[model samples]
Target: MIEEPKTGMNIIVKTVTRLTTGLILLFGIYIVFHGHILSEGGFAGGVVIALSFIHLMLAYGREIVLKKMSEKVSELLGNIGAVIFIIIAVLGLFTGGYLFFDFFGKGKPFNLFSAGLMPLYNIAISLIVGAGLFTVFVTLVFFRSEKK
Candidate 1:
């Protein structure tokens, strides 16, 4: 019988990782969305989000993680996040608000969508941080040059 090439860690490790990865991702999303009301904000939430992917990479090896999130995709997402953040900031100028303005009306306290553009800003920042960190990690880990 031909043995399959080893791709990741032992079965127990993989099983535990599979059980927790989704929870980690969900926690990151929660942090991003509730940032305006809660203490956790864009950067913190973004790091958490990035950690989820990083955890996957660690458990499954670089190849599988790359397949799920390639370098190109990560770079593109990082750029898109930056653009979205810039657009949101610039939009304030046209609305007669400050450079970093909150254009939307504040709803009930401690509620999602209450902080207007803050949530959007948090989301944009999360995307930038998560994708950018992952891209950097991947490039550093996978693209080593061989000496002649």
Candidate 2:
């Protein structure tokens, strides 16, 4: 008797992906939040976050991953991130006479809230990077190469 093909990877891989996906996502978020105090920043953290979703797509199928985060949603998120970043810059310009000026108060040194607008910038950047990369990945996955 012939068996049907599986849509995604084998059960072992799927189980491992299921276990590790959340941890990857959390680690990315941690990197984004602690970037000012630590070495890693939004760009690094955003790549990690995007990797988590890509991991899911690789372990599962595109359909399953797309169900969780559709291309439209990813694009929308990226646009929203850009808008938020711009808004913050505009607010800073109006308040401090320069674009992206640190208008917020700088709290205690070595503290989580010490960076003024830096943390907010990191969050926005993470959103932009994560969504943009994910969208690109999806588009590449759907791209079809024609045979000569």
Residues 15-96, model 2: lDDT tens digits: 8999999999999999999999999899999999999999999988888988999999999999998999999999999998
Once fitted onto the true fold, the runs of candidate 1 whose alpha carbons sit more than 4 angstroms away are 1-5, 145-148
Best by lDDT: 2
Q: In model 2, which runs have C-alpha deviations exceeding 4 angstroms?
A: 1-5, 143-148
* lDDT tens digits, residue span 1-148, model 1: 5454388777777889999999999999999999988889989888888899988888888888888888899999999999999998888888956787767777787778786788999999999999999888887765764242
In terms of lDDT, the poorest run of 10 residues in model 1 is 139-148
How accurate locally is residue 57 in candidate 2, as Cα lDDT from 0 to 100?
A: 93
Model 2 / residue 84 / CA error / Å: 1.2
How many angstroms is residue 22 displaced in model 1 relative to the true structure, after the best TM-score fit?
Answer: 0.7
Q: Which pairs of residues clash in candidate 1, taking residues 3 or more apart in a chain or in different chains?
A: none
* Colliding residue pairs in candidate 2: none
Tell me how far the alpha carbon of residue 73 in candidate 2 is from the true structure, in angstroms, after superposition.
0.4
Give residue 72's lDDT in candidate 2 (0 to 100): 97
